[model samples]
Each structure stands twice: as structure tokens, then as C-alpha cells.
Target: MSSSFFGDLRVVLRGARFRRLFGTRLVSQFSDGVYQAGLAGFVFFNPEQHTSAGAVAAAFAVLLLPFSVVAPFAGVLIDRWPRRQVLLFSSLVKAVLGVVTAVLVAQGAGPAFFVAALLVLSVNRFFLSGLSAGLPYVVPRDQLMMANAVTPTCGTAASSLGTGVGLAIGMIGGEDALGTGIILFVAALGFAAAALVSLSLRYRELGPHLEEEPEEVRAAVRNVLRGMLSGLRHIGDRVPARDGLLTMGVHRVLFGVATLMTLLLYNNTFTGGGVAGLAGFSVSAALLAIGFFAGAVATPWATARMSASTWIASLLATAAVALVVFGLPFSPVLFPIAGFVLGFVSQAVKVTVDTLVQRHVDDAFRGRVFSVYDVLFNATFVLGAALAAVFVPPSGVSAAVVVAMVLVYAALAVGWTVRARRLSATCKGRGALWA
Candidate 1:
């Protein structure tokens, strides 16, 4: 494998299938950013909506809990259906739902508006799961790490760019119900464009390589639980991937708490909840993009030289120290830097875990594994937010919450380091197995 990130990219992007899949991810996630930003403005910055820790938790639950509900079905179905078609059709559904969501947003922020938004995001879960499951089909098995790094980082960058554009639309249109609706409608067009791009792929372009006959709907529904358990068991047997996932779950919960805290800080204490708060939010978003890009660039090169476990342990430890050093102050200058650090940590860990899962899991269960991964990602985050809502203030300044995140990061770092040592001891080719 190449030590240089660009070298890995040059080798991997040479595949036409990879490029098509990568393009689909970029366009779809970019639209996701726009949709998320549109909703964020309405829920967090709009004077009309209430901004509180409890409210933030409620909004996250409304948007994310449904993603958990759909994961089992999505996993089982993705394994049965063609992944290429999954991306194409899911995008189409999202486009239609986005329009409906825009119409609802114009009626004012309510349960109906959130329901519409969540529907768009729920459909998005399918599109995203397909991207992860389909990646191994596109790239060389040897360079999966670089592929993971580049695709998600670039998708996130595209999403961040879309966020700025959406916010600009909201601002131009007055940042009200009508403005937010316009932003969402424009975002819907992006989804349509994504669907158009996905048309380039052949029917079996991205595959589960299914050898068995398709199961009946009732049978599949009954099998969802069985399938997920199978996935979990499969993961448990792949020690490295299972450990990576456990590490990821820990990061998500801490990250989730920090996320709500940031929302509250921006909405209330940091800027007093208006365009000023939005600007601060935008700055953090931009910094996050930079951090993600840096992490992406760094991971491929760094992991080329070190074990994946070592890199992850280091990053988690860095997160613990960075949070206390930069976040304790909670000054505008320091907090954004903290956001950047966490962003980098997030991408690096995720890129590692994504590669581990894809590398270890069989194609037959890949979709199901990624979908269960979907549940692990969102469900844990929501769990964290719900737990934090009990204590985090509207001002978003909770020394105790920050302390909790720091301690968790530290503990996870130690645990991962010890596991890396164990993997090294038990495996003949430790680097090859873990990395």
C-alpha cells in the first residue's frame, strides 16, 4: 500500500465503479447537509422555536429515533435488493419527501414539520448504508482504508459546503418559515440530481452477491431480528472490527453530549440566539470541515505507518486532553478549536472502524452489519443526549458534562490500547490483522 494519501487515491479512483459510487455519496450527503441546515435554522436559530436543552433533546429524538426503527428492516432489505437500485430509489423517495417537508416547514415548526424532516432522513439511512456496503465492490481490497478516508471526508466537505449555501438561502429569504422552506426545496433538487447521477451504474454494479433466492416479505420481517443477531455474532468473532465498533460507540455517546451542548451554547449563551448564533454555528461548521479534511488526509498516511489500533488510541487520548485544554474556557475562540479537534478525532476513528467492518465482514452480511452500525451510531448518540439533558443547562456550560466526556475519552483510550496489545500478542500477523 502507498504511504501517501494521494497515492492511495490515484490507485483506487482508477476504478470507474468507485468513482460512480463516490459521486453518488457526495451528492446525496451534500443534500443532507442542506436539509439539516434548513432544519437547524428553524429549530435552533429561529426566534419562533424554543431553544433549550430539553427542546434540543426532543428534536434529536424526533429526527433520529426513527432511524433506529428502520435499521433492522433496512439491513435485511439491502441484503436482498441490489445496492445500486437502493441508492437510486432511496434518493427518489427522499426528493419527494423533501418537497413535502418544505411544505410542512412553511406551515411553521411543529410535530408535522419534524415528522416530514425525519422521513427524508430515514430514507437517507438506506442511501447511506448502501454506500458503505457497496464500497468493497468498487475499490481494491488492499486500499480500502484510503477509500474510506477520501469518500466520507469529501462527502462531509460537500455537505459542509451545502450547509453554507443553504444558510445563505435562508438568510436571503429572511430566515423565516418561508425562507427555510425555500432552502429545503432547493435541497430537494439536489436529491433529484443525485438520483440522476446514480443512473450511470449497472443493475448489479454494487452487490450483495446474493446466491440464495429472495425470501418472502413476511419471512424477511421475521428474520430482521435473526439477521441482526447474526451480524452481531459475526462482529463478535472479528475481534478487531468488534473492538473498533465498541470504540466508535463510546465516541458517539460522548460526541452526542457535546453536540447538544454546542447547540445550546450557540443558541443561547454564545450569541443569544439569532443571526449572530447562526454565524457562530457556521464558523464551527467550517472549522469542522477543515478538521475532517485534515483527519482524512492524515489517517491514510498515518495508518500506513502505524497500527490502526495505535492510531485510534492516540486520537482518543488526544480528544480527552484537547477537550479539557480548549473547552474548559468555553470562549468563542477556544470552543471552535475544540470543535475542530473533536471533528478530526471523529473522522479518524470512523474511517478506521468503517475499514475494519468492511474488511472483516462477509458480503452476505455486509448490509446488515452496516445497518446495525447505523443503529449503534444514532441510538447511542441519542442516549447520550437524553442522559445529558437531565443536567446540561440551556447556557450549555456544564463543567460536569465536559468532565464526563473527558473521562470517557480517557477510559476508551486506555481500553483500546490494552486491546491492541492483546491483539498483538495473540495474532501472528498482528499489524495485518488489526490494521
Candidate 2:
């Protein structure tokens, strides 16, 4: 490990309040894992359910698309309301929805189940946004980067842990609606636990304190569109922010394609039926989680030897080539390896993009920029999934789709090279590019 990595870890651990805040994030994200894993098990693995590429894409859309549509509104609410309250109430609501969803799943209620699941997933936008908004309050500004490094990475670990537990539950329960229902019941309890953690924080501890008494409810709704516009304009004005976000968006699209391909391969090709398919998918997911952790640990060390921009481009290029290398044979055994590589490379790019945006964008517009970021992230992901449904087959072995991913990733890498060279020249003249 590099000195910066250890030093950052030491500084973050020394803060009591940050630890508590981190705990809250850990609990919430863990519950998120349980909830999502249960849903995937129910929708994709149940013997009673039919699986296809389009069906998988629809499921992915149900999980994320509506939330993307409402993200701007959720961002407004995150800024307007007290964030501590937002986390507390949103989590509680998710708990109730979880219980309802479990009942729907058990009863074999189809559309109703999706409707309930959508609500359960949608509330998370507020909870996660509040957590991101509240980070600055828990730690000193100098420690912010380190805080970001530890908090999300740990939260992701907790989430992956929850998924592992859910998988165990699924294995014991078997591949029925009843088993899935039981898993979701446990997920509900997890959300309730997260809500309890939220209670430990002071009321105003996570905040977007209104400087003056603000707008009426009707007016605020009207301004949501305007706020989104202002955020776009803000990104447009900053070259580094725009470029970094573009890189992140491109990665999300490619990641989405990879995700759907993996899901279909495991659910329909590798096992093709029963509880074993879920187990296969779970193994793939676990490998991806390990890769995510590896990426976080390795990114700081890698950046010490190169600029973040160069590293970002290099990672993308590597992913592009590796996709072709690992995916050409299209073996089920190779998919797990591909999953790990994609997870590591994509996460490294994400961390770099996040740091770049934070450094370049001003505090006043940070929330808005992130809201825009969230929208682009989810939208591109949904778009990719939808496209994959059109391109990938039920077997998840489509040479056409593989070729498309390689081309897109390679093109993004070339674009990154051009942007990095321009930014390098700009930095030489100006002292810093991000600033």
C-alpha cells in the first residue's frame, strides 16, 4: 500500500462522527443488497418464472428506470428537506414496501409485484443522495477524499455481504415463491435496522440548511426543470467536469451491456433452470464484488504513477481489449473472469471521475451536478440494458453484441486519449487542470 492510502485511512478512522455516519451508510447499503438480491432471485431464478433477454431487461428497467425518471425530483427533495429526516423516513418507507413486496411475490402477483418493487427501489434514490450530501458534515474537508474512498467502498462491501447472505437463504429455501418471499422478509428487517441506525444522528447533522425561508411547494415543483437545466449549464462551462462526466456516462452504458449479458448467461445458459442458475449468478456477483474492492484498494496506488486522466483512459482501453479476449470463447467459466475485470476497470474509472468532478465543480453546485450525474448514470445504464435486450439472445452468446461493446469501449478510450492530451497541455500552462 502507498503512504497516501494508509495516511488517508488513518485520518478517517480517527474521527468519531465520521465513523457513526459511515455506520449509517453501511447499514443502508447492506439492506439495499439484501433487497436487490432477493428481487433478482425471485424474478430470474424461480422455477415458476420464465426467463428471456427481454424479460431480464424489463426487470432491470423496473429496478432502475423509474428512479432515473424521478431522480431530479428526488434531488430537489434531498436539498429541500433535512437530510437526516430524509434518510430515516425513506428507509422506513422501504421497509414497509419490502414487506408488501414479499407478500406480492408469495402470492404470485405479477404486475402488482413489480409496482411494489418499484416503490421499494425508488425510495433508495433519496436515501443514497442524502448520504452523499451528508458526507461533508461528518469529516473535515481535507479528509474528504479519504472519507469518500472508505465510505462507499465499505458500504459496497456490506452490500455484497448482504447478497451472500440472501444467496444462502435462497439455497436453503429452494426455488419457489415461498423461498423468495422469506428472503424478502429478511430484507425488510435489514431496512428496519438501517432506519434504527439513522436515529443515532442528530436532527440537523445531515443538512442542506436553507439560508432563508424558501419557496412554496408548488413553486419548487415548477423549478425542478430549471434546476436540472442550471446543472447542465454548470457542467457545460467546466471542461474537466464535462469530460469526466462524459467518460463516466460512457462506462455506465458499457457496464450495463456487460451486466445484462452476465445475467442472461448465468440465468439461461450456464444452469438454464432451477436453483442452480441462481447459484451460478450469485457466484458471478461475488466475483464482481471482490473486483470492486480490489479496484478501490488499487486505484490510489496506480494513480501515484500517472495522472488520473491517463489512468482512466488506460483502464478503459484495457477493458475494451479484455472483453474481446475473455468473451470471444463465450464460455461460462470465462464469464466470471470477465465480470471481475469489468468490475475493477469500471470502478476505477468511476472513482477517478468522482474525484475530478469534486475537485473542479464548486460546492454550491455540487448537489445539482451530482443529480445530473445520477440521471446520466441511470439513463445510460437503462438504455444499454434495453439495447442489449434487442441485441443479445436468450443464450447470452451473441457475437454481434460483443463486437458492439468492444467498438464502443475502444472508441471511448480513444476519445479519452484526445481529452487527456488537451488537458495535459492546459495543465502545463495553468498549474492545474481541475482547478
Candidate 3:
């Protein structure tokens, strides 16, 4: 909202290194959006498909839960490899996988279709961690927070725009196998574009320097066994970073359930299970996109005025209140408003946590910690969808789920307030830590 905030964006984008890196992220995430939109259309929005809560839960678990298990390995390698190379090869792999996935979708949105898509999505997580891990190298520490604020938000906005593109493609493709396949093929092209963009960054330009690389293959194996623990220890007892992880992981669990309910409600209950359902859900997605950008715009100014803990606590509490206010009656018109509010809150919290980790964790362990971050993020979301399967009805109207999320948000907010006050009372670095 302020001229100075716009000034900061200009400042961060001014560098060639940052520009190349930023361009890579934007292009890759746009592909992510396009890919996801195609999947959603084939799996959920297709009239021939009969979607259930159990099916949704199983789909997410199959796609994400395995990825969560193997993610640490990717993290360890990311720390060992040149990040730019990781970006390049991962993009190349994902592009090929994207084509494979498109072919499977054309056959039918079958078991293999999900599995192929999972491979692409898993590589996406690895690529994203490398981006985050390498970010500190491109921007000054002083500007890292602003960089986090800008990059993820813009990336998400690109994803949202890509979703719009996917939707338009889906229209031409007509929500069938052939249509979804065409959309996915377009997404694959986007990945190829990302690979080309990544070439602009020199090898090892974003990295764990040569001295830090493991000496041998056996050492790499040993590193994998111990590296996760090292990353966890590195984050230990630093209240802001640790609690930030906990809050975000929990938030995703609750939000994931909410997302399931929204999808089911729009498709089965609100819009009557056709193209209309997807069109309605797109409204929520669009609102969320706007909210993400709003959060990025608001965070720097908000954090500058108050401690990160206070700001994050206020956001969690606001989500609780917003869920109650807008989700109570489960009105079709109101859920999108709730989506916008929670989207803003979610992105703001993420930006804060990213800054917390970037500022607090050592560079050597950043990839691992962020790997841990991704595991928690994805795992909890699956847990939420699983919980939804058990509790939320197919109709997606569940007062119980609404009540549960509010309580969790309220509890997390209280915990944040108490714990932060205690930590600030004793921490020597509290001034820097909380800021």
C-alpha cells in the first residue's frame, strides 16, 4: 500500500542474480498452477467421475505422503549439489514426467495418472526447496524478508494466473481425458521454459560451497542418516522458528480439511457437480490469489511495526474469528470471503516463518530445515484430508469441522502469546529474534 513497499520490491528485483532466480521461480510455479488445474479438472470436476471424501483423502495421501517420506533425501542432496543445477535437472525431469502424466490422463484419470502426477509434484517440492535454500545467496540478509514477501506471493499469483489459463484450456479440452491431456501438455511446456530460465544462473552461484560438499558416496549416505537430525537440532528451542513450524504445520492440517470441504461443497452441493462447480471454486481460488499478494504487501509494514510473534498470533486469531463468522452458516457466498481471509493469514504466516528460518538457521543447514518444513507442510495437509474423510460428509457441510478448526486456531494463538512473552523475557537475541 505504501510507496516504500513498492520501493523495496524495486530494490530486490534490481539485481541480475535475483531477477534470473525470480524468473525461474515464477515460471516453475506457473507450471505448478497449470498442472494442478488440469489434475483438478480431470479428477474432481469431470462429470463422469464420482468423487467422494474417501477418494479425495486417498488421492492426497498417495500423492503427498510418499513424497514426504523421501523429501529429506532430496533436501540432503540439494545442500550437497549446486542449487542452480538442481533447478535445471529437476525442471527437465518434471517436464518429462509432465508429458508422461499427460499421456496417462488421456488414457483415463486412473491409478497411473495419479502416480505420474505424484512424481512431477515431488520434484516440484525439491525444486522449491532449492529456490529457498539459494535465496540468501542472491539477496542481502537485510533484504531477505522483503524477498520472501515478494517471491512466494508473486509465484502464487503466477500459479493463480496459470490456473486461469488451465481453465481456459480445460474449456477447449472439454473436461474429458483429451482435454485434460492438452492442458497438462501446456504445463509441460511451461516447465521447459523454466529450465531455460534457470540456465541464466551460473553453476554453483547458489550453493553449499566446495569445502562443504561431502567427500564420498559413503559419506553422502551417512549424511542422509544424520542430516535431518542436524537440521532439527539447528532449529531447536529458537522459539520463533520452531513455533512458526508448529503453527504452520497445524494450520495446514486444518486448512487442508477446509479445502476438501470447499471442493466437495462446490462440486456436490453448491454448483451441482459439473463445469459449474469448478467455475464456482475458481472464485475462491481467485480470491486466495489476491489475498496472497495482499499478505505480502502487508507483512513488511506489519512486521516493521510489531514483533513477528505478535503479528503471526494476530493472524491466527483472525482466522479463527473469520472461520466462525463466515463459516457458521456455510453459505455459498460467504465461503469465498473466508477463503480470502484465511489465504491472507496463511501467506503472511508463511512469509514470517520463511524469514525466521532464513534469519535464524545456519546456511549449511537451510536446505535440511526447509526440507523438514516441507515435510510438515505436506504431511499435515494429508492428515487434514484424511481427517476430512472420516468426519466431513460428501456434501461438505460440516459444522463439527468448522468448530474444530476454530478451537485449534484459538489454542495456537494463545500458545503463541504465552510462549513468545516468556522467550522474549529471557532471550538475549529477543530483539533481533522477534523482529
Candidate 4:
């Protein structure tokens, strides 16, 4: 079974288009991981030069804000433009920004450089959103779950490896200036590689433009505005898609809350122990990455054993349990264990939800549907982080807020799943529009 699973993964990897995209993503994700580490280190070590941690966090918030706000339009663009060209343009812009950031930082331009870096990061995120929105066009619907699982698994692996290497380089470089240069150089290389690979891809038209007619444009605008309403209406109108989105939404919210909690704990609570704290945090992250990889490897078997909805619900419940476990004042050993479990379950949910969305949504509107989902997920996370920052002081309050948020989210998810199941049954009996 393992051999067969790997064989299937190999086939996906070997596909010409997937290979190019995957190859680009592999390098880009690695650099992204390294850049993240370097960014944190840069802030921590040189807070006076750049900005406060709070400011940095706000920048991250800004970077992600566009995904929720502009994603519908971005999705439309993805569907309208040649995906390869979109990717190429995005990557080239990112590379240029990276070089500009490196130059500004090296010149000791202070907070301005940091602001510029944040802007560039925001741009890079937009491109990533586009790539994610366009993914359905590259792979067949049937294989989407596996593809989703594999891409993130690969990305997590790269993150783990890249983080460790970046840390080592940062330590060796011995100064913020030197470290920033090295890190930015790597980011530039990654973006360059992504641009080159994107250029190599053979462009193919997926379908009709999302807004070919003025009436269609107006309708698309209305549809996007009514997306949440449309989603709710569709839930009443279509059972499978409704159930899938509900399950996926619950999973995303839980994962987001739990992740925020863990990161806050690591950054704040575990600070005093110095190298020990750092080592513990790194180990916890590595374990989480491994968990994601394991979950992806097992996705095919898990799918074979249960329906996607069942898999999704089970994963959400498992993640809820993990969050509770993490929140408890337990031994340090339990922290990593909880983190690993959360990571594994979250990866399972991601794969299942992505698969369900791809299968259930109309092919023409797949990008928009996924974009809507992405917007919800991103918005919730930003809200969670903002609330945590606002309500939770720099001390114990932050941790407490994070824990409480996770528990609340978990309860909501449980309720949602129950309601979704009941709705599914009722739709079946009434011969309603759900299924």
C-alpha cells in the first residue's frame, strides 16, 4: 500500500506541468521559510532599528489582508489571464522587491526598509493566492485531494529544512545586516527560479473568461458581493457542497486558532530559556512538519476507508482535542505531542476540504469558490491574531486569550458539524437541492 501510494505521488510529480510548478514551489517555499525565520530573528535582534514586534505583526496582518479583500478580483484575474503569465509576472515583481529590500537594508535605511519589505511580502502573498486559486486548472479534479496533500506536505518539509539552515546561517553571519543580506539573496533566487519555471510552462486556456460581457461583469461583481449569501443559499440548495464547505470552514477555524495559540506560546512564554527555548520550539516545529508529511502520505488510505466528510469531521474533532491538550498546563513533552497531533489532523482536514471543494463546485467557478473559502480562512486568522493582540497583554493574558479562543472555536466547530449532518439528512428526505 505504501509503495502504491508513493507510485501515485511519483506520477503526479512526473507530470510535465505539475513538475514545473512543483519545482518552482519547492524552491520558493524553501526561501519563504528561510525568509520567515530571518524576519523574526531580524525583528527580535534589532527591534530598535526596524520596529516593535507589534508593528511587525501588524505588517503581517497587512500582508494577508488583501487576500480576504482582493481575492475575488484576484481569482477573476487568475481565470482571465494565462496562469503561467500571471505566475511569471508575480514572481518577477517579487524578485525585484526582494533585491530592493536587500539594498535598502544594507544601506541602514531603518524603518523605511522594513516597511518596504512588508509591502513586498504583501505582493508575494497576492501571487501565492493567485497560484492557489489557479491550481484546479493544472490538475484534474479526481487527483486534487492528493495533489493538495502532497504540495503542502512538500512545503512543510521544505519549511522545516529551510528554517534550520537559515537559523544556522543567521547565527554564523553574526549581525542583522549580514543575515538580512543573506536571507534576501535567497528570497531573490527563489523568486527568480519561480519566474523562470513559470515561463517554461505551456500555457493552456482553462475556460471562458470570468467576465467577458458587461452584464457578466456586473453579475460577477454582484455574485462576489453575495458570495457569503450565495454560499449560505447554496448550502440550503446543495447538500454535498454545503456540507463540505461547513466541514472545511470548521476545520480551518480550528486549525487557525490552534496555530495562533502555539505560536504565541512559543514566542512569548518560552522566551526565558534562551537556546533551550529555541531548540524546543524548533523541535516542535519539525515534529509538526513531519506530522503533516505523515498525514499526506496516509491520505489515500484514509480516503479509501471513509467518506471525505467523515474524514474531515474526524480530523476537526482530533484537532480540537489537541488544542485542549496544548492549552493544559502539562509537561513540556506534551506540548510537542499536542503540536504534532494538531499538525497531522490539520493537514488531513486541508486535504479533505480541498478535495471536496474541487469535486463539488462548478468547474467554471472553482477559482472563485476557492477564493471565497480562502478569504474566510484568512479573515478569521487575522481576526484571531488581532483580538489576541488587543485583549491579551504582553504577558500571561495573551496565552489565556489564545487558549480561550481555541476552545470557543472548537465548540462552534462541533456544533457546525452536527448541524451540517442534520441538514444533509433533511435535504435527502425532502428531495431538496442539496445533494
Index of the highest-lDDT prediction: 3
RMSD value for candidate 3: 2.4
After TM-score superposition, the amount by which residue 235's alpha carbon in candidate 1 deviates from its true location, in angstroms, is 1.5
Q: All models: lDDT? A: 0.85, 0.77, 0.87, 0.62
Can you write out model 4's per-residue Cα lDDT over 1-435, one digit (the tens) per residue? Answer: 222446657757766767777776777677677766666555533433323235434654765666577766655555456667777787888788777777776676577766767666655655665556556666775566667778767877886777887778767765557666677667777778778877666665333344554554435435545543444344356556656666555555545445544544555565442344455667878888878887777776777554555455566666666757665653456777877886787677666666656666654455556566667667766765555445544432244654664665467567646755765665554222222
Pick the winner on TM-score between candidates 1 and 2: 1
* Candidate 1 lDDT score relative to the true structure: 0.85
lDDT by residue (tens digit), candidate 2, 302-386:
7655667777778888888888888877888887888888888877777667777766665445666776788888888988888
lDDT of 3 by residue, 12-75 (tens): 9988899999999999999999999998887777776667899888888888899999898788
Could you give candidate 1's per-residue lDDT for residues 276-378 as a string of tens digits?
8888888987897898888888898777666788789899999999999999898888998999999999999999899989988888788888998999898
Clashing residue pairs in candidate 1 (N, C-alpha, C atoms within 3 angstroms): none
Superposed by TM-score, candidate 1 places the C-alpha of residue 261 at a distance from the truth, in angstroms, of 0.8
What's the TM for model 3? 0.95
Q: After superposition, how far is residue 321 of candidate 1 from its true place, in Å?
A: 0.5
Q: Every model's Cα RMSD, please?
A: 2.4, 2.9, 2.4, 4.6
Estimate candidate 3's alpha-carbon lDDT, on a 0 to 1 scale: 0.87
Model 3 per-residue lDDT at 325 = 95
Model 2 segments beyond 4 Å from truth?
1-7, 212-222, 428-435
Higher lDDT: candidate 1 or 2?
1
| C-alpha positional error of residue 243 in candidate 2 after TM-score superposition, expressed in Å | 1.8
**Residue pair clashes in candidate 4:** 237-433, 238-434, 239-434, 239-435
